[model samples]
Target: MSKVTGDAFNFSLLKRVMAYVKPYRATFVWSVLLTLLLAAIAPVRPMLVGFTLDQHILKGNYTGLVNITILMLVLLVFQTAFQYAHTLLTNKLGQSAIKDLRINVFNHITKLRLKFFDKTPIGQLITRTVSDLETIADIFSEGLIAMIGDLLQVIVITSIMFYMDWKLTLAVLVPMPLLIIATRIFQKAIKVAFQEVRVEVANLNTFLQEHISGIAIIQYFAREEQEYKKFEKINVRYRDANIRSNWYYSIFFPVVELISAMSLGLLIWYGSKTILNNPTIEPGIITTFIMFINMLFRPIRELADKFNTLQMGMVGAERVFKVLDTQEQTEDIGTLAPQKLTGNISFKHVWFSYDQDQEAAPKYVLKDISFEVASGQTVALVGATGAGKSSTINILNRFYEIQKGSIAIDGVAIKDYQLAYLRKNIATVLQDVFLFSDTIFNNITLNNPEISFDEVVDAAKKVGAHGFIERLPGGYHYNVMERGATLSAGQAQLISFIRALVYKPAILVLDEATSSVDTETELIIQNAIDKLMEDRTSIVIAHRLSTIQKADLIIVLDKGEIKEKGTHQQLLKLDGYYKRLYDLQFSSVGIAK
Candidate 1:
């Protein structure tokens, strides 16, 4: 949602982008050398034609004219060869640089803290990595390298014109100051236009991505017409931004052509007047000066267009660098590298909130919360919606940092353990399980080559998912489409359980893991849960109290505070919030016997 605003020619951003080009420096150097050679060769044909006209053909020397023509043909071949080499080398250089840059952006994004993703739209990040990177490739393939060649061509042509005749050259350059002013104005306008175009493009992609992912919900609610209208508005904005950019181009090219024609006319007018007075200026010199003027202005015209390419590329580079420069990365300062944890967790005097800022009023999700789970015990968290049950689990996994608290595992602060090592010891299964669009076997192993096929089958069999998976077309190799759409909700949940079990973590966290399963599946999952929880710390957030009745301890939460703590039977005798919740559930659906 952030707008990109910067100068059209940003040297700092250019230097940063060029750093990516440095790795393929050898190829880039070859491309630049080819560009210069092409520029040097470009003027030879016109110069040769002028020489042939003044010295050979006009004097009726047939052999001399034939030799000049053959030389011109040879120069053409060399020019063609140089152009081909330049194109091939620059393209290879551009692609290699973009490949490295794209990887760097993706790597940086992975290192960013969860909070960064919480606020940033996934579509914006996609645009930064994909489309914006393509624009940067244009800088090498179509913009920067070509612009350099154009610059050299312009300089060479201008020098050749002065050598031929200074007076005519001065006359041809008379319109230059006006052309420069016009170009500057065009650059400023197009820069703003391109920025608007990029902003609208990002907005459109964000809107489309969100709507497509939630299309099922939209159709279920019968809001198709409403969603379509919203999309139309976004599409119109994107179209209008592009039209504005085209409007600038529509005016720019003709103005350049008019200036070029006027300069050519001035050159002819001055040559005619000088010829009458001196009688020494040859027609071929006039012819060659005209060709030189065209060569010079042609680059000028093309440079305007290439400069726009350069500006757009700079805009993309600026956006990409912003993401790369972000400081919202997870801190990995801990040195502790334990092979396995003892699964003892303690949250002492924890005061926490999602937002931790000095100026904002504190909105704590957990306050004065203190609890401990022994090395091998099942602790269940039961609470009403928005009662901090899920937040407690999130903190234990260290998904978000806690503001005022010390969360320790095996007597060491959670922050004192290496982040990756800490996470590897904890496995979680959420109510809404997500599976990648991969074979069931790969999904279970998460593409980890270390996890053998036998290990996966054993994990699934233990979780009671193996029977259903074997009935499928490909058994373990069945490809579950995006989000595992081919699998039922209960089946998906079972696969998630299998995934967690295969990891053999020191701690397991389940958030409403069985809330979607039927009675039969729930029983099967419960049996698996019992086996999975043995000799490991387990945390459960359960809506179905029956599923957690045998937990070693049950902690009842109300409005971010613990209101009751006991065994299920002990809590019932206490007749507190837990008992009330239990009775209400039993009265509505009867207790599962």
Candidate 2:
């Protein structure tokens, strides 16, 4: 994985991130009003301190001091109440915004086509969904609170300072420009450093995930040491990224503190000199000036830290929006229309390739090919690796579109049908079967919610899965781990077959269904499949020719072109590609049996 960079934070990302706040406008407005009230009330404390200094301390007016002190206490109570309300409002608004963003990103991901999943790493996607989202929540909650409150407090303190004495106010803010420049510099460095940190974290997650999933193969091959070395390289980069982030924060805080301290010192010196020369400048006013400076600098200090966090959040926002911005594979024009298609399928003069740069690559994964399967007939596609068997199946299923020519299902153009409608009518069992981490019943029924429990069990029985499921500790209630890691590959395949059986689609596509199973398991799966295919139109993509011997038609592919097409007996008589593949797999079995 490549390192994440600061350029990921584009203007478009910010625009999208801001869009989440629109729904929570009422909550945000209340939060802002409360925050402004708190800011307006903040200056009262310093004014009260000044009153005590002049009336009680300087003049020694005890009777007046008591009233003034009580008023100050009352204002403090109001300030505390405003703070409580502000916190509640902002927290409510922030959390609601996060919920909206999370839902939007999730919904977008689900709508994306299979091709996006093929290219994007699962770990990176998970990072965007979980960790990055949490970071954005922090930015919305704490970062927004700090930034908005700081700016408002600064404005309030400045107004109060100018009212006390304009000359001293200008002097105090002499260091403001320097502070802004310094903050800008820190922000630039922090953005770059945090981007590095994000990259390292994503890389670490991907590395760990890959290694854990492949642990069995790594151990069997005795490649543990090699994998360990590889992990160390990524771990070291993560460490370095973290250290760099720490370094940025470390330098930034001290410089910001120094600037704040220097400003206060300059303000104190200038205010005292002005008061000494002009006796009308009461000691109370000086006290208030010092108090205002303190309050002002605190938020300023917080602003520096909050700004850094916001920059990091922008990086996260960019990653999430990138996924949202991806183009969906194709528009569904069918609108879930019911076509009630017959089983007949036709591939007309089809030429296909996956490459976008077709001119330079000039590589057609499937050259001109045409075939037809009549309703309820079985067509077997057999070939060596990269011979376009799976490609043909994918095209027929509308998983992809061909470069030239058309595919028609029951005389209707496949493109005219919605993806959901097309897929709903077709069931495919791939060599690699994926089962969710759910109960056996859910896995078989795919948690349709509409499919009843009895129907699921019936489907399982048809696929021979019910027999072993009954042997499990919980029978149909047995829970499968992620990707069915708890079961053997053959068992997973059986469960997949049962899932297809339950759907009972009109057209069934089996891509090497029995290729990975042992002889006994193969027989169980084959028997179940034979029963499942009794009336449905079935297309089987197989390497072992015996599996397709019963097929009404077998189309043999060689180097992206069909070299032979006929029944098993007819192909044997032709003495071509089909006969050769048949000889390789089942010739010995034929003699032994």
Write candidate 2's Cα lDDT for 460-481 as tens digits.
7777778898998898888988
Point out where model 1 deviates above 4 Å.
Answer: 1-8
Task: Report model 2's TM-score to 2 decimal places.
Answer: 0.93
Question: Model 1, residue 26: what's the lDDT?
Answer: 94
Score residue 452 of candidate 2 by CA lDDT.
Answer: 89
lDDT of 2: 0.81
Residue-by-residue lDDT tens digits, candidate 1, 490-556: 9999999988888889999999999988989998999899888889999999977665687888999
Computed on alpha carbons, the lDDT of every model, listed in order, comes to 0.88, 0.81
Off by over 4 Å in 2: 1-12, 61-74, 544-546, 591-593
TM-score of each: 0.97, 0.93
RMSD versus native structure for model 2: 2.8
Give the least accurate 10-residue stretch of model 1, judged by summed lDDT: 1-10
